[model samples]
Each structure stands twice: as C-alpha cells, then as structure tokens.
Target: MQVSSLNEVKIYSLSCGKSLPEWLSDRKKRALQKKDVDVRRRIELIQDFEMPTVCTTIKVSKDGQYILATGTYKPRVRCYDTYQLSLKFERCLDSEVVTFEILSDDYSKIVFLHNDRYIEFHSQSGFYYKTRIPKFGRDFSYHYPSCDLYFVGASSEVYRLNLEQGRYLNPLQTDAAENNVCDINSVHGLFATGTIEGRVECWDPRTRNRVGLLDCALNSVTADSEINSLPTISALKFNGALTMAVGTTTGQGKIFTSLEPEHDLNDVCLYPNSGMLLTANETPKMGIYYIPFSKPVLSSSLNQSLPPAFL
Candidate 1:
C-alpha cells in the first residue's frame, strides 16, 4: 500500500498504562482533532546495518524494550536497545544459531536451537543449560512466565517442553494434513502455527488444542503466478488479543481480523501492550511500517461481532 503522506499514517502513543476503553476514547478525541489538518512529511530513513552473515531470525521483546537477532551461519546472538537503536551486546554460541527466542516475560534469559539440541543462556551470566531433543523445530514460544517451559513446532506436531525436567509434556494435535510447520508464535495466552501450505492455526496453550484457524492461500483460479507460488508461510504473529498477521516466503503477507484477510503485510511484529504494529520486508526495496492502533474502533460493535477468529 502506498502512503501519500505522513498524515495518512497515525501513531497513537499509548505508553501510559490505560485500560482499553479509556485508550480508545482518547484516540477518538485525537482523530477528531486531526481530521482536517493538511500536513504531510516525508518518511525519514532510519539507521541501516550490513550483516556479515545471513540473519535467520529476528524478534522484539514482549515489552518492546529490546530486540534479539541471530544468523544461520554464525554462532552468535546480538541484542539491541530498541529506543536508542544501538547494539547492546553479543554472545557467541557453541554451534550455529538456527533459531532463538527471547522470553517476553523475562528478557534476562534466551533459548537457542541448534541441529538437534537447545541451549539456554542468561543475558548476564552466559551459558546455563542445554538439552538434546528428539526432533528439530524452526521456532519456539515460551509458556507464560515459566522460563523453563515452552512450545516447539516440528512438522505437523507441537511439542511442549519442560526445560526444568528436560522432557516434553505432551504433543498437541493439529488438523492440517502433511502440515509441515514453518513458523510459530505465542502471545496473550494463545499459540499460533503457520504451515507450508499457507495456513495458520491459533491454539489455546492451556487446553493444548486449536482455538482458531486461518487459510491464507490465494484463490488459485484468480491468482497470478506470483500469488500462487507464495504459499509457504515464513513468519506469523498475533497483533493483539484479536487480529493476526502472516508473512510468506514469496515476500508477501496479510493481516487478518477474523478469517478474512484485511491487509497486506511483510515481516510483522505486533506489540500487544503498546497497541502498535511494525512491518518490514526486503523486496524491490527495504522499508519499515509503523502502525498505531486506534482504541476507538477496537471495541466497536461491528468488530466485536466479527467472529472468534477476530477475538
């Protein structure tokens, strides 16, 4: 989507702790105030970094305070301060970092996945523990505040790992066939998995069962070649307790409210606490999008009546 001006973009600052209702009412007031202001500014270019190796995974912390990134060919993980946009620290690992996770509840510890094992390291103390697993997975999401428990997606199955016990609790079942899980995300007590066939499923971690599902595949007969080939999901995330977003390998993506896709997306990061969405991608050019949530429509009757998928 092309943005005509910065005025077309609205970023509501919800940093101060406010209830959803209060936040929405405040946003509506602001929108009414800016409705006629014909001011526009060019989008400013931010700092850019040239990586030495292929950056495989990138994620922002739950509180949106820090950013954690790693590469496939490198054995090191880097931490960046979000506000300053400066490098904070880096730590080398024993093996190549396939994928890594920063616990939202506790950013002090991080977990990394190697060939067939996982390693846990403290932000300050360094390597604390490691475990050998039976299967390898692409992504992992923490189980609430339990630093030692998390979920891993491998193929079509989701495995719950008890880090303290060094064993899996039970495998969660998915309905998709030959569902090779490509990516996984967890937030707001919900777990979501994206598959190679371009489908997404949001599950309830407590029940270890599917709560909602989304089929992101384009209409085959009406889609062009590019749309048809872009069916493998490379990334996925939930915007808040309601909306969800997914990015595909073909450099395409979508944002969803309920089962119907609403907006095109790229590499997306949803901040539930802050009510903001950040999207980035590498295509003809590299760019980043910052979208702030307006609390006014968030609780609208139409939105509330949409579906469980939207909820």
Candidate 2:
C-alpha cells in the first residue's frame, strides 16, 4: 500500500479505492486448525447513569479525550473519558432527549435537543446556552472551524445559534413542512438533512438554500402489490470533491462520487480506510469507514473472506 510518510498523515491507510486481498493459503490453514482468537476481549456495558437507555447518537471528541452519549431516560446526557471509559459527568433533563450533538471543533461544549422543543449548550461543568425550541425534530449542524455553536433541527424550523452574537437567526423555512427530518450532517459550508420520507437534501448553510435533492422516498406503482422499498436515509457525509454518501437506518450505506445524469454509486465504505463495500444484512453490526483513496489501490480479499470486523 503506497502510504505517505508518518510526519504527514497523508491518508496513511490500509488500502485504496479497493482493498488488499486476503491470503487464501492462510485462511485454509486456519480452517484446518479451527483456531480461535487468543485474547478474550470483554464487552463492558457502561452503567454510570441511573436509568437504562439506548444511545441514539454518540460522539467522540476530536482529541479522543471524552465521549458523549445521549438518550431518553433519567439522566439524558453522560460523559466518559475516552481512554478508560470512566464516567466524567452526567445531567438529568426535564424532557426526553431527542438528540445530543457535540457542536465544537475542540470539544469545548455539547448541545442536547429535547422533544419538548428546547435546546441547551453545555460545557463540562455547566450550561452555557439554554432556550426553548420552537418545535421538535432532528436538527443538522452548520459546522464552523473555530466556533462552538451551529444551526440545529426543529419540527418546522432551522436555528442559527451563537455564543458571541447571542441571537438566533430567523427561522429558515425548513423541510419539516412535509417530512419529518430524521438526521443531519455538515462539512465545510454544505449541510445535508435526512427525512423520514426516505429523502435527503443538501443545503447551503451560508445561504440557507436547498442545493440538491436525492429522491430516496419509497414508492409503489399501480400494479405492484408489495411495497418496493422503504428508502430510509439515516446519515449523510461529504466524500471526495462533489461526492457524498447516505447511510440507511438499515445499516446499508452507499456512496455516490459523481454528478453525471445517472444514479451510479462509485463505491461503498465498510471498514475505515479500506474502501471495501459491504452488501451484507447479517450479524447486525456497526463500523467506521473512511476513503483514503490515493493511488495503487489494493484488491479486496473477500476471496479468502477475512472476518468483516476490525482487524
């Protein structure tokens, strides 16, 4: 793999657009022996917060110092040390937490949104920004380089939150008019919002305008008895250049890297930096992925069928 020097992390990765093929002989040897993993890694369930709740969203700080988990329960927000998973802090909320987002470039503050129409920004110790939401729903972020606050979601509004200005922008007539905005992601000046209708739209955060729309809504025609698809758009992110990706609630995420007049998917990301597309529906798992495409990309090793989890 043509990796760049360590001094500059010029995408030091495992492979390229494809992946390095697995060693078929090595797999045969392992099958003969029926060897098992030597080390026993325990899955520790964190139990610092009182009420048991599933984390709908989780964010790790850029410096890898802390983690934030948000959910609906007694203690809505939980903070942990990234290194040891030690409980750092916790907060109880009056309403069920619908979303929790870390809205800082340097992990300085965290923002939690409630179903009761409220938004609060917090530091590690105390609250910094607290206001009632105009409506209820998921909000996407408008990322800025150095600042802490960004735009958030609502049932029928787009919020422009700030620390210094201490004011909110006039509600940018949002898509909550017809579809329930499920999730949002932003990079640079572009932001994308997903809807329960299975559609995703890209918006210019600076202009508060819809730039492009992807028709992912499930549709059935007159002669069809069965529903064709439940096109759920769960997550969105910027890839290379004008490229982007959309992950479904079903965990099958696909990438589109072209702007041609056709719906052609360029690649898929399963393993981080591997660029090996995953088309499986079994095991029910989650993974991180990145596209460090440079040159001399390696071929996928699925012939030997290496384990699909982290190496």
Which is the leading candidate under TM-score? 1
Question: Please, what are the lDDT tens digits per residue for candidate 2 over residues 1-311?
Answer: 22333223243222112211245586564554454332112122232421253344455665656656555445466676745646777676677666566655435677777777777777756677678755555654535542323344534455555545566656555564433333333335566666655666666666768787776544312243344456455555554445554555443322222111112221222433334222211111211222354222322322211111100
The reply for model 2, stretches above 4 Å from the true place, is 1-53, 105-107, 145-156, 174-176, 179-187, 218-232, 248-311
lDDT for residue 14 in candidate 2, whole number 0-100: 24
How many Å off is the CA of 247 in candidate 2? 3.8
- The clash numbers for all candidates, in the given order, read 1, 6
Native-referenced Cα lDDT, model 2? 0.46
Error of 2 at 79 (Å): 1.3
- Give the 10-residue window scoring lowest on summed lDDT in candidate 1: 302-311
**What RMSD, rounded to one decimal, does every model reach?**
11.8, 12.5
